[model samples]
Structures are given as C-alpha cells and as structure tokens.
Target: MRYETRLYNALGVRLTAEHSLSTGQYEFMWFIGGWDGCGANDLAIAVGATSKGVDCMEAAGW
Candidate 1:
C-alpha cells in the first residue's frame, strides 16, 4: 500500500475578505470538488487554498 500527499503554498498570497466572510472557504470547496467530478478547469485560476501552485501526489494502492 502507498500514500498520497497534496501540498499548497500561500507565501505571497492575497485574499479578499469582507464583512460577512472570507472567500477562501468557497474557493477551497470549489477547487477540491473539481477533482471530485464537480466541474471543470480544476487547474485554472487560483480559486482558494487548493488553487494554483498546489502540488498533489497519489501513491500506488492495492
């Protein structure tokens, strides 16, 4: 059995925050969902946490 790991970097990141809440949550959900057969362009546009400059690794399994 193997393991999978995903890395996200937000070193020089900028986020838009307002009175209600930060757009971070929404973006993360959409980005991750895209990988789960949610929509398209899962690699385009930095949506949220799991956005651009993110690294994902899926190891072999049995």
Candidate 2:
C-alpha cells in the first residue's frame, strides 16, 4: 500500500510539473475526453467524487 501511494504521488507530481494538471483533473479529462456525451454527475461517479466537485472543475474551465 505504501509503495502504491508513493508511486501514485510521484506520478501526480510529474503530471503537475509537465502538464499543469492534478491527478483528479487528469482523471476527469481522461474520462470525459474518451466519451462523446458525459455529464457532471457521470464524471463525479466515475471519479468517485460528488457532482459539486465536477461543477468546481467546470468553473475552473476544465
């Protein structure tokens, strides 16, 4: 579990440094970018977050 968390955090840092995206934003983009028609609620469920989180992402111009 520790190894997994470390690896995930390392990847998140790399992503943020290279692409200016947090892991959550990357996950959100990965899901929405693949689908044709995905709603905020769908993304929230997919990412295991609340719909309001998705709304915040939208507000940030995600």
Candidate 3:
C-alpha cells in the first residue's frame, strides 16, 4: 500500500510536470484513444469514475 501510494504520486507528478495533464486526463486520453468504440459510460467504468463525471470530462474537452 505504501509503495503503491508513492508510485502513484510519483507518476502524477511526472505527468503534470512533463505533459501538463492531470492523472485523470492522461488516463482518459489513453483509454479513449485505445478504445475505438467505447462510450462515455464504458470509460467511466474503466476509469472508476461516475457517468456524470465522464460527461463532465467530455464537456471540459478532455
């Protein structure tokens, strides 16, 4: 658990510093890009987010 937290935080820092993206945005980009026919609900489930949250991400141009 401790190592996982540290690694996650480190990944977040690197993503932000290098790409100017939040972890969620990075995840969304990769997931949506790789998933050719996925809907927002599927993305929400895959990313552990709510459908409403996925809608919000789309609205925000994620």
Candidate 4:
C-alpha cells in the first residue's frame, strides 16, 4: 500500500476552507468550467483574487 500526506500553507488552508463553502465552491467550479486558456494573472483578475491565490488553488489540485 502507498500513502501520501497533503500539506497546505496558511493561505492555502484558508482558501481551501473558503472553497468548502457552498457559494465559494460553486464559484470556484464555475471559474474552472469557464477557464479558457487565459494566463494566471488574467484568471486572477477575472476571479477577483490574487495570482498567488490561484497558484495555491493549483497546488491544491483544484
């Protein structure tokens, strides 16, 4: 058997928790579905968040 531990930074954890909310999770999913090959910065602008936050989401495998 194999196992892996997932680690999250403070911001990452916060973002994760926020995304767990019904509205936040829905928005996140909407963004993912609506993504159209835009750059991270562009996506950040479109989503009203920082690029760093987007990076965190990417790291979280969302």
Largest lDDT belongs to which candidate? 2
Poorly placed runs, candidate 1 (over 4 Å):
1-21, 37-62
TM-score of each: 0.24, 0.63, 0.59, 0.38
Model 4 scores a C-alpha lDDT of 0.56
Residue by residue across 17-52, what tens digits does model 2's lDDT show? 986779978886788889988776665545545576
Ranking of models by lDDT:
2, 3, 4, 1
Residues 1-62 of candidate 1 have per-residue lDDT tens digits of: 12222222221133222222234444644466567664325545544533332322111110
- The candidate maximizing TM-score is 2
- Once fitted onto the true fold, the runs of candidate 4 whose alpha carbons sit more than 4 angstroms away are 1-22, 44-49
Residues 1-62, model 3: lDDT tens digits: 99999998999999889866778777767877887787766655455465666667678666
Candidate 4 residue-wise lDDT, 20-40, digit = tens: 433454465577678777565
lDDT of 1: 0.36
Clashing pairs in 4: none
